[model samples]
Target: MDERELRNCFGKFPTGVTIVSWFDGSVQKGITVNSFTSVSLDPPLALVSIHKEAKACTGMKDKAFTINILSDEQESIAWQFAGSKQEILEIDWDNKGISPKINGSVAWMECKPWREYDAGDHVLFVGEIQELHFEDLEALTFYQGKMGSAKQLVK
Candidate 1:
């Protein structure tokens, strides 16, 4: 299989940028992900797919985590967590809860670990949403290997 070609094909679909954050003991950790989605409404479940080798993959198990949907203006924040060499950002994190919440995200979901499954190259982490919040703001998006702002298709 042409792995690069497959990734290119998958990249054609636009996805919202997100940061999956959790705490390892007293240290805060996060990873940039675009593969976040709601799984169920009755139980209020959410999912974030993390690469099997990602540091967060091991640290996030059995822990509370937050899925922070980035605002369009937060591209730098996304890059910072994605391991870019840019200057470290003075991130404002709300630590009153079990997990840290990135301030200024368009939306955020605080979740308790529900289950995890070994996917092909990623581990699917499903969480039960305990609390969620959102703000009215344009979202950051990724498509075709580039980052951009989402377009408003309707009022």
Candidate 2:
């Protein structure tokens, strides 16, 4: 299959949205990411995939990162980060201490790099969870190129 076909196939799988953040001097840089997952519960490890050509890819390679899991109310926050200009809104980042994170996200996982693997067009970054925080809220999800809500799973 071609690139478009491959991307479409991948899109079939819905995933949660996250903001992968890292510090660049006094500025904290991050981007919206959906290619993130838990790798091991025993070690509290997670992974995020970034495009090889993306600017954030290199920054993540050398520094610690944070995965801010968005809440359903954070759709605007997600859109801002994912937008072409990377326009972020005025958010309450005081809770983050040093790094920046969206206010009222469902959870935040602060991590340090464990390893990096080179995939075809993306680099898979494995991270060891150093810190984690959670709030009482529903998570946001993405499916087939659109934001979606999760319904109850009836047994």
lDDT of 1 by residue, 102-132 (tens): 9999999999999999999899999999988
Taking all chains together, the TM-score of candidate 1 against the true structure is 0.94
Provide TM-scores for the models.
Answer: 0.94, 0.86
Per-residue C-alpha lDDT of model 2 across residues 106-134, encoded as one tens digit per residue: 99988888899999989999988888899
Top candidate by lDDT: 1
lDDT of each: 0.90, 0.80
Q: What count of clashes does model 1 give?
A: 0
Alpha carbon deviation, residue 114, candidate 2 (Å): 1.3
Candidate 1: clashing pairs of residues: none
